[model samples]
Target: MFTQRSRCLLLIFLLYFVNKISSKVEFTNIKCNTFDPDFASFEYCFLKSVNRTYKYLSIKVNLHKTPITKVKVNIAIFKRYNGYKPFLYNITKDACKFLLLKNPDPVSNYIYNGFKSFTNMNHTCPFEVSPQKLPIGYINQQVTDVLPVPHGDYLFHSNWMAYDIKRATVNVYFTIS
Candidate 1:
């Protein structure tokens, strides 16, 4: 007894949940040493987590030898088709200028933002955390920010934060969509 629009919406919603349950994230292997060059580019370092039922992507950047001030990360989520496709929307800089301009540590940023759910309709990172940092390290496996991504095959790319910097790893946990 559902209307056509309601049925369509329900189907879409079900498909979204199905993709979330079945989707997997795979990360490329990255080897890093303290003496590695600054701003090194590493390939196959994207994230891929599969069959996860969570509702948030937990991004953790662990910093050991590398200082937090000397790290930076640029993350982009791309959709997978025959080839990888980038998300259509541009991340709003002003919406999260507080984190981008101020450069607060990851823990403080998460605390400031609080635990708010990120859905398909809402893709903005909270004011406390921005996607990229001039220099970044050690998020302590916290929910740094809400990723603007939907279910299905998507590539998670990070720059500067996932390379040869001693003991630094960028970990992203995607929640169920």
Candidate 2:
């Protein structure tokens, strides 16, 4: 008979499930091509050998002369290559190496040049994730940061608002064996 409010609701549900598994962070998600960029196979899902995997890729652009102001699109994550690798490989591999988070630091070469960058709109290219030198605050509109992705296919380039510059390209594919 476990009484006393059922042991305080099982100790607050085991401390909220162990603090959500100790602040869980490790990703592999490539979604946001619900097709509409003049769909014609939408350019074959922004092909590049077509195989968009992921591990921490977030892009949200919607700012055309203000109102919903959002501008946070500069995520470069890659690890393996041609064969692909590292997408939630259990998170620990240095938390998915790659960091250039928030505040005045997001533009790993090329944007507004060649299909508005994001590595030429998501294409499983670029091998080597050691691009870090960012440290502080300039992504505005709804803060959310944790850019640590490495292992394979990575290219996140977006023009998510900041005066009106349309572009979206997020192709995160990672794997580690």
Candidate 3:
């Protein structure tokens, strides 16, 4: 036995809970471009789908120069509206310094944690690029832990820089449903 206002409030709460529980994040596409081929080159960069429900992103970069002492990464997120417009997140971080942190910033930590398990860039300064292609991906894993955002298409754009020079850019497209 509930009043009208109480029933309406309960229904709203249930709807919110259901929406939160059913939300999922999936990678739709990825694009990579190198600004300086002499410094670095993309070996492979693409989104891979294993099945209808499973997909992953894979990327590899071959660095011509060795012992990269300084590295920085810029990340920006965009949501599709009339076109693509900037969303909530835009971050810039020194890669080496961030790797050394015991407890990093929340935003950077969230982004790093998402791909840390699949990346070889876990160590601090003086990175020696190996001859082999370094693959970074979340194989067979669906991204569940993510920022709470409305269901929409998103673009995660990142710039990889080394030695104060922009080396490459990666654009990852995803959808939340």
Per-candidate clashes, comma-separated: 14, 20, 0
Which stretches of candidate 2 lie above 4 Å from their native place?
Answer: 1-4, 7-9, 16-159, 168-177
lDDT sort, best first: 3, 1, 2
RMSDs, each prediction?
11.5, 15.5, 4.9
Residue 156 displacement (Å), model 3: 0.5
Q: Highest TM-score: give the candidate number.
A: 3
**Model 2 score (lDDT):** 0.30
What digit string (tens of lDDT, one per residue) describes model 1 on residues 81-164? 677667542221222333454675553344334323321212333212222211111221221223223445544344343222
Displacement of the residue 42 alpha carbon in candidate 1, Å: 14
Between the candidate structures 1 and 3, which one is better when assessed by TM-score?
Answer: 3
Q: Higher lDDT: candidate 1 or 2?
A: 1
Question: Per-residue lDDT of 1-177 in model 2, one digit per residue for the tens?
Answer: 899999999999996765443222223344443222421112223212222332223333222222222233344333445643333221111111222222322333222221222322332112211112111121110112233222234323222212233344445332221
The sequence of per-residue lDDT tens digits that candidate 3 reaches over residues 40-75 is: 998888766676765667787888887788999899
At residue 72, candidate 2 shows an lDDT of: 36
| Model 3 weakest 10-residue run by lDDT | 131-140
Q: What's the C-alpha lDDT at position 68 in model 2? A: 23
